[model samples]
Target: MKTLKIFSLAAVSVLLSTVIIAQSKTETFKVSGNCGMCKTKIEKAAKEAGAKEASWNAESKELTVTYKSSSTNAAKIQEKNSSSRV
Candidate 1:
């Protein structure tokens, strides 16, 4: 009975820890940009908005960003990117 109680407590602790952890989210979206300079600006804006990683493709006009949901969201990144455009 004591061992059973300990196991249950341990399980609860693990579950709680998992719930408390922040999750990373990756999102890809279209961002209009004309050249390499635009790619740099777009990526920089995403990073400034708390993105862990940001990549922009000039040809495809796509931006992919990874960020923690606890700190920032895709909308915020997109807003920043749009405002940074030339």
Candidate 2:
């Protein structure tokens, strides 16, 4: 009886964890810009938009972002990210 209860609790925990992880989405896209200033701007925008992780490679012009899909998406990220060079 006690063992069965423990197993049920473990199962519930796993299910809950799975649900939470499933809700978080990750995506990468190409963005146009240059220099350290552009990198700062891109990363900040993504983090503010609820991205768990964001990296921009200036040489490649690629931005990799991991975020909660429920809170944001690729298009929104790009729109918020694309802005002035100065």
Per-candidate RMSD, Å: 3.3, 4.8
lDDT of 1 at 13: 97
Write candidate 1's Cα lDDT for 6-73 as tens digits: 99999999988776657788999998988888888899999999999999988788899999888999
Model 2 clash count equals 0
- What ranges in model 1 sit over 4 Å off? 1-21
Q: Which sections of candidate 2 miss by over 4 Å?
A: 1-22, 83-86
Residue 35, candidate 1: how far off, in angstroms?
0.7
Native-to-model Cα distance after best TM-score fit, residue 44 in candidate 1, in Å: 0.2
The residue-by-residue lDDT of candidate 2 on 1-86, one tens digit each, is: 99999999999999988788668777889987789988998888878767888999999999999887767888878777764233
Which consecutive 10 residues in model 2 have the weakest lDDT in total?
77-86
Extract clashing residue pairs from model 2: none
Q: Model 2: what TM-score?
A: 0.67
